[model samples]
Target chain A: MLTYIVEDDPVAAYLAELMIRKEQFCSEVQSYVNGQRAFDSLKEANETGGALPDVILLDLNMPLMDGWDFLDAFDSLAIAKDVCVFVVTSSIRPDDIEKTTHYKHVRGFFSKPIDEKALKRMQHLLEVPNN
Target chain B: MRTPDYLQAELLDLAVADATLFNFLHGTVLDGLWYWDLQAPENGWVNSKLWLTLGHDAQHLPPEPNAWQAALLPADFATMQQVVAAKAADAACHTFSQVLRFHRLDGSEVWMDCRALLLRNEAGTATRLVGALLNITREVEKEAYAVEIANHYSTILSNQSVYIIKTDAAGNYTYVNDLFYERFGYDAQIIGTSSLNSIIEEDRPKCLDVVAQCFVEPEVPHQVILRKPYNNGPVKSNHWEFKGLVDEQGQVTEILCVGYDVTLLTENLQKSQHLLEVTKQQNLRLQNFAYIISHNIRSHSANLTSLAKLLDGNGNADQKAIFLQMLNTSTAKLAETIANLNDIVTINTQGAIAKEPRLLKEEIIKTLDALNVQIRQHQIRVEVDVPADLLVPVVPAYLDSILLNLLSNAVKYRATERPAFIRLYTYQEPGFIVLAVQDNGLGIDLNRNRNKVFGMYKTFHNNDDARGMGLFISKNQVEAMQGRIEIESQTDVGSTFKVFFSTNVDVDLYS
Candidate 1:
C-alpha cells in the first residue's frame, strides 16, 4: 500500500511518515508540507499512468492551502484510484469535526498524536473489502 | 256750550303744547314709550322711539297694546306679567321694573329694562298704565362673559397634573395646588415657610440663585431640580420651571413655580444606561473568547501534538534526548497557556464584582512594592504624582492587578540605552476618574499593532517573559468594574496607559 501525509508542520509530517513506514502499513510513504503541493502531484498522477497513494492523511491548517480546499479540488478530479482520506487535526472544535460530513471521500476523523491503536484501526479498515 | 272760535283755537293750542312736552321727555330718557288705556285697548299709544329700538320704520308699527306684546318673546312676556301682578298686589309699589327680552318687527330680539307705572283716578281705581323701555343687551352679554372666563381657569387649576405653587417675594409658600401636595407630601404647614429649604443640600445654592434671579427679572423663567424628602420612601425628584408673577405696575408680586415629578424618569434612564454598558461588555468578552480559542488554545495544542508524535518515533540516543527535552518544553507551554486561558475566562464570565471607593495612591504604591526587586535591578525611576486621598470607584483586586500589570510591563520593555522612567498620575474628567501610567521605554509601533496590542498571546517584543496575556487580562479586569483602558504610544519614545473609572459608581446596577 502507498500513502501520503499532507501536514503544515514539518515535525508532524515526519512523524507520520515514520509511523507508516515502521508499521509497514504502506509500501511507500510520501509527504507534502501543504495541501496545494499534494493536490498538484495527485493531478499529475491522474493525468499520467503514475501510481497514486491508496490512503491520505490530511491536516486542516496550513499556510499555502488547507485540507478543505484540497478536498474540493480532489473531488473534482475524475481519478479512479479509490483513495481514502482521513482528517488528522489537533483542533477538537466541534465546527471542524462537523465539516467532515460534507466530503464523501473522508473515511474517518482522527484527533492528533495518532497512537498504535488508531493506526491498527486504520489498517483494519484498509483490509476490509470495498473500503 | 260752544265758545267763540278764538276761545276754541286757544284750547286746541293748549292740548298740543301738552302733547309735545310729553313726547320730548319720553324720547330723551327712554328708548320707547307706550300708554295703555284699559277702556279702549286697541287705541293704545306708542312713541317713534319704539320703532327705532325695534329696528323698523315707524310707519310699520301698529298703535295698539297687543302689537307691543306680540313683539316680545313669549318667556319675557310671562315674566312681565309676573312683575305687573306683583306690583298690582301692593298698590304702594306703584312702579314695576323688569328686564325682558322683546322681539322686534324685523324678527330679532333685544334685551330691555322696562319700567311701568300704574295711573289711578281720583276714586283710587287703577285705569291707564304707562311704561318706559331701555335697551340693556350690552350689559347682559358682558356679565355672561365674566362668568365663563372664571369657570375655565378654575377647571385647569383643579384637574391638571402640573404642580402649581405660589410663593411670596421672600420665598415663603403662599399657595400650593392639589398636585403639589400629592407629589411632595407637603401639608398646609408648609405654607408661610421658606420653600427653598426643601431642595437637597448639595443643590440648595443653585436653587437659591435661580430664585433670586427670577425675582430680579420677573416673568423670565428659570429651571431647577428640587428634592422632596418623605418619611419612609425615597426622595422625590421634581423638575420645576419658576417665574415671577408680576403686577400691572411691573413689581414682582409672587414666585410662580410649575413642576412635575421626575423620579421615575431619572431611575429608568439610569437603569437603561447600566443595561447598555453591560451589553457592550458582554459583546467584548464574547469576541475575546473567540480569539483565545482560535489562536492561544489551538497553537498550544498543535505544538503538544507535534511534540508527542516526535517522541513516539525512533531516533538516535542524542536525537531522542533532544526530542524529549522539546517534548517537556512543549508540555509545559501547553499547561501554562491553558492556565492563562482559564484565568481570562473566569474574569470574563464571573458575576458582578464588588466595587468601592479605593485610594489610587495606595494601589499604585502596593504595585510598586510588589515590583521593587525588578525596579531596583533595572534602576528604574518611578514618579507618583497622584493625591493620597483621590478616590476611584473600583474593585480592589482588579485595581491591584491592573497596576501590577502596567508597572511590570514598563520594566520588562525598558530601552536598552537609557534607564527606565515611569510616572503615575490621576486627574478628573467630565464623569470619570482617570489614572494614567506613563513609561519611558521601548514603545510599540501602534500603526502596525494597534489592533493586536490588547489581544491574547500577541507578543510584540522579543522577550522570553512576554507572554502577551498581561494587557489582555488587565483590560478585561478594568472593564469588569465598569471602567475602560486607553493607550497612546509611539514607536520608540514611550507609552501611556490611561484607565478611567466612573465617578458615580454607587448606583445599584448589578444589585
Candidate 2:
C-alpha cells in the first residue's frame, strides 16, 4: 500500500514517516509540505493515470492552503478508487473534529503525533472488508 | 282711533302727573333705587323695592351712608368701597357699576348689579347720588360655579409638576404656569414671544409642525420631542403633547401644551443599548481568544511531544541531534505565545488607562522616525495631512505601539511594481478624533482573510517577520483605551485604517 503525509511541519512529517516505516504499514510513503502541493500532485496523478495512494494523512492548519480547502477541491475530482483520508490536528476544538464528518472520504480524526494504538486501529480497519 | 272715556282719562293723567309716572317707574320698571344727597347727608331716601326684597320696611326710609352695612356681605362691601366708590363724585367721573352681594331677611345671599350716577351742582361737587340696583343673583351664581370648576381644573394642571403652556394660534406664548417658570427657569417674559424660540434650533421645525397640526386638526392631539437649552446646565429634553383649544364658535383659538422631561429616560436607554452592544462584542472577542489560545499552545506542544518521543527511542546520533533542535524551537514558540497572552490579559485586568493630550503631528513624527529605516529601504514616500497641533487624548504607550504597527505594516507590505506612498490624515467627528493611515502597498486579501487578519498566529503573506500577533495586540490595546479601529480595503487595492480617539470621556465606542 502507498500512503501520503500532507503536513506543514517537516519534523512532524519525518516522525510519521519513521513510525510507518518501522511498523511496515505500507509498501512506500511520500510527503508533501502543504495542502496545495499535495492537491496538485493528486490532480496530476489522476489526469495521467499515475499511481494513487491508498491512504492520506491530512493536517487541518497550514499556510497557503488548509485541509478544509484541500477537501473542498478534492471533492470535485472523479476517482475510481476509494482512498481513506484521516485528519490530524493539534487543535482541541470539538468543532474541527465534528467538521470532518461532512466528507465521505474522511475515515477518522486524531490528535497530533499519531500513536501506536491509533496505528493498530488503522491496521485493523484495513483488514476489515468493505462490506 | 276712538278711545273709551276711562282709557283716555288714564292716558291724560300719565301726561299731567309726572310724579305719579316716576312712582310707577320706581315700583315696576326699576328693581331698586336710592338717592343720597351729599349736600345734606341726613336727607337720603331708599325706595320700597330696595328693602322690600329683603322683607324689611323700606317705604321712603331714610338711607344714611351706613344704612346698607348690615345687609351687604362684608367682603363684597369692602370690594365695592374700594372699586365702585373710589372715583370722586365729579362731572368727569360720575357713573360707577359693580356686582355686589347682600343678605335677605332669611339670611340667604343676593347679588345686585348696582349702577350709580352722580348729580353734580354748579360747583362741580357731588350733591345727589342716584344708584339703581338690579337683582343679578342667578347670573352671579352661574358665573361663580363656572369659576369654581375652572379653579378645580387649574389646580390639577398646575400642581402635577409638568410644563403647562398656552399659546395663541400664532405660536406666541399666552401663558406658562408657575411650575414651568419655577422648574425650567423661565418667567412671564416668555409671554407674547414665539414658543419656538425656547426650543433648541434643531427641534424648532418639529415644534412648528406640532403647533400647525394643532391648528389644522384641532381635535386630534399632537406630540413632539423638543430639546430645551438652558443657561446654566446641560440641554434638557421634554416630551410635549399639544392640543388645540377652540372657542364657542368652534374655531381653534389657542394651543394648550403639556410637557414631561424625558432627558434621563432617553440617556438611560442610550446607555443600556450601548452597554449591550459592547457586551456582545466582548463575548465574541472572548470566544476568539479562547479558540486562538487553545490552538497556539497545542501546536507548539504537539511538536514537542513528537520530538521527545523520537529522542527517547533508540535513534542514530544525528537523528537525536535533529530532534533536540526541533524541541528547542518548539519551546521557544510556546514561550512567545505565553508572553503574548499575558499582554492581552493585562488589557482586561488593568483599571482605566491613563491618557494624555499629545499633538497628533508630533506623534506621527515620532512614529515615522522609528520606521525610518524600513521607509528608506522600501523608498516609500510619506504624506501628512494633519494639523501642526491637533490634540488627541490617548495613552502614550498605546499610541506609540499602534502607530508603530500601522506605519511599519505599510512599509512591510509595499508593492514593488510602482512607487510606494503612504498618507497620514487626521479629522474630527462629533466627539472623536480620527487618525487615518492610507497606504499604496500589497493590500490584504480582505474578502478571503478579513476575519483572520487580526487572529493570533495567522500569517497570510508567509513573510519571515509575519508573526500575525501585531494586529491582535493592537486591537486589544485600542479597546483598552476605550477607542476603536476600523479597516477599509479591497483585494489588490490599498487599505485605510481609521483609529478614533474619543474627545469626550462620556462618549462610548459603540455609541
Candidate 3:
C-alpha cells in the first residue's frame, strides 16, 4: 500500500509521514506541503500505470492551494477511484462535518489531536476500501 | 305765520335798511337766504355775506334768473333744472336740499348742501325762489379717512398666509384672517361672530388652555402648539406644530403659528431607530464570534502543546507515532483559523472599492461547476436560472467568493434522507438586482441565530467538522462590493439567501 499526504505545515506533514510509516500502513509514504504539487505528482502517477496511494490524509486550510481545491482538481483527473481520503482538521464547526457528505471519495472526518485509536480506525476503513 | 304781503314787503325793506335788525335775524337763522328774479339779473339779494362763500352772488343778479342752475356743479345740473321746473308750477311752499360740488372762483372745490323754498302766485305757480347753500366738505373728508384705515388693515389680514387672530380676554376671537379659514376649513362669515373656543376642538384643548393662561396672566406670551393632521392626504398619520403668538399688552391674546409638514421626517426617524437596533444585534454576534475563535484556537494550541510533550517523553514507538500525528493535525487547524481571522480583519479595516463590471450569471455557473463533484455525489439538482445578460456592479474576486460560499453551503447542508435540490435565479427589482440561492437543506433557525450565522467561528450545530468561517467571509465580501445579503430559513426545511446589488451595468465607481 502507498499513502499520499497533502498539508502546508511542514511539521504536521513530517509527523503524519512518520506515523504512517511506523504503523506499517504503506510500503512507500510521500508528502507534499501544497496541494498543487501533490496534484501534479498524482497526475504523473496516473500516466505511469504505477500503484496509486491506498490512503490519502488531507488538511483543508492551506496556502496557494488547499485540500478542498485539490479535491476539486483531483475529481477531474482520471485516477483510481478506490483511493480513500480522510479529513483531519481542528475545526469542530457543524458546517464542516456536514460538508464531508458532499464528497463520495471521503471516508470520514477526524478532529485534531488524532491519537492511535483514530488512526487505527482510519486504517480499517482504508483496508476495506471503496470500489 | 304770514302777515299781509304788503306789510311783509314793507317790513323786509325796513329791516334791510336797519343794520341792528338785519344782524339780529342773521345771528338766529340756521340757513343763509338769498333771492333772485328774471326781471333784474344783476339785482339779486342775499341777507348775509356768509352765503357768498359757497359760489353765490349777493348783488346784481336777475330777479327771475336761473341762479340755481349757474351755481350748480356740472354733476347736479340736470337734477337742479327738473326740481326748479316742478316748483314753478305749484302754489305750495316747497323746500328741498341737494348735495353738489361747488367750484369756487379760486378753482378750489367744496361740497355744498343747498336748500330751496318756492313761493307761488294765485294760479299755483312760483313767483320767486329763495335758497341756502352750506359748505360740508370737511365733514365728508374726515369720514372717508377713517374708512380708508380700516380697509388697509383688513386687506393685509385677509391676504396673508400666517394665522392672524385677535381674541378678547376671555379667549373669544374678535377677528381671524383668511388663513384661519383655509387651515380649519371654516367659513369666514361663520367665524366672524363665533368664539375661538368653538373651532378649537377637544383634541386641541391644550392649545386653548395655553391661550387662556396667557390672557389671565397679562405678561406671559402664549406658546401654543396647533397640531393639525397631515394635510392633503389620507394615508398619513402625522401632525404639524406651530409656535409663538402674543397679544397687545405683551400677553398672548391669540396663538399665531406657521410650520411645514413633517410626515417624512417622522417616518425617517422610525427607520433610523430600526437600523440602529439591527446594528446592535450584529455587534453582539461579532463579539460572540471573537470569543468562539479565541476558545477554538486555544483548544488547538493546547492540544499541540500536550502532544509535543508526549513526543518528548521516552515512550514506545506506537505512542510516539500517535502523539506526533496529533501534533500535526492540531497545528494545521491552528494555521487555518489564523488565516480566517486575517480575512475578517482585512474586510473591516480597509475601505473597499469594487469598480469592475462582473456578469452575475456567469459567476454563479462557475461556482456551481467548481462544486460539480459535490453536486453529483449528493445526487443534487442545481437549477441555474439567472439570465445570461444580467450584470452587476462588483469586483470579480468578491463576486466569485460570494457565489462559491453560497453554492457550497447548499450542497453541504442537504437533507440526508432525500435528494438535494438548489435553485439559483436573478431578477431585476426597482433600483436593484436580486440574486437568490435557495436550497433544500437542513435549514437554520433564523429567528434564533440568523444574526450570528455570518459571525466568525460561530456555529449552530454540534457537527465536529464545522469551521463556521465560510458564511462570515461571504458576508464580508458581499458587503465590500456594496451589496446586501438576506437569509430566510427554518430548521430541517431549507434556506434561501438573497443578494442585492445595483443593477446599473455602466456604473463608473472611479468617479
As a whole number from 0 to 100, the lDDT of residue A1 in candidate 1 is 78
- Indicate the docking level reached by candidate 1: incorrect
Better of 1 and 3 by TM-score: 1
In what order do the candidates fall by DockQ, top score first? Answer: 2, 1, 3
lDDT of 2 by residue, B1-511 (tens): 6658888899778868777777777777777887766665555566778788666765555366566666778898677556634555335888988787778877888888889787877888766778788988888789899999999998977876688899998889999988888776787888999988878898888888888898889967799889987544689889999999999999999999999889998899889988898888888878767877887777777778878877889989998898898888778878988998888878765647677888889989999998888898888999999999788888788889999999998888876788999999988888689999999777877766676676666666758777777888887787777777888876556889899887765423454
User: How far is B208's C-alpha from truth in model 2 (Å)?
Assistant: 16
In order, the Cα lDDT scores of the candidates are: 0.79, 0.81, 0.67
DockQ of 3: 0.03
DockQ of 2: 0.45
True contacts kept of 2: 0.50
Those runs of model 3 whose alpha carbons end farther than 4 Å from true positions after fitting are A1-131, B1-48, B51-73, B76-79, B82-93, B103-108, B164-179, B182-184, B188-219, B225-374, B381-405, B412-484, B488-511
Query: In every candidate, how many clashes are there?
Result: 0, 0, 20
True contacts kept of each: 0.07, 0.50, 0.03
Off by over 4 Å in 2: A1-33, A47-57, A73-131, B1-68, B73-99, B103-109, B114-134, B147-275, B297-335, B348-352, B357-394, B402-450, B461-466, B478-511
Clashing pairs in 2: none
Better of 1 and 2 by DockQ: 2
Better of 2 and 3 by lDDT: 2
TM-score of 3: 0.44
**Candidate 2: global Cα-lDDT?**
0.81
Query: Which run of 10 residues does model 1 chain B get worst, by summed lDDT?
Result: B37-46
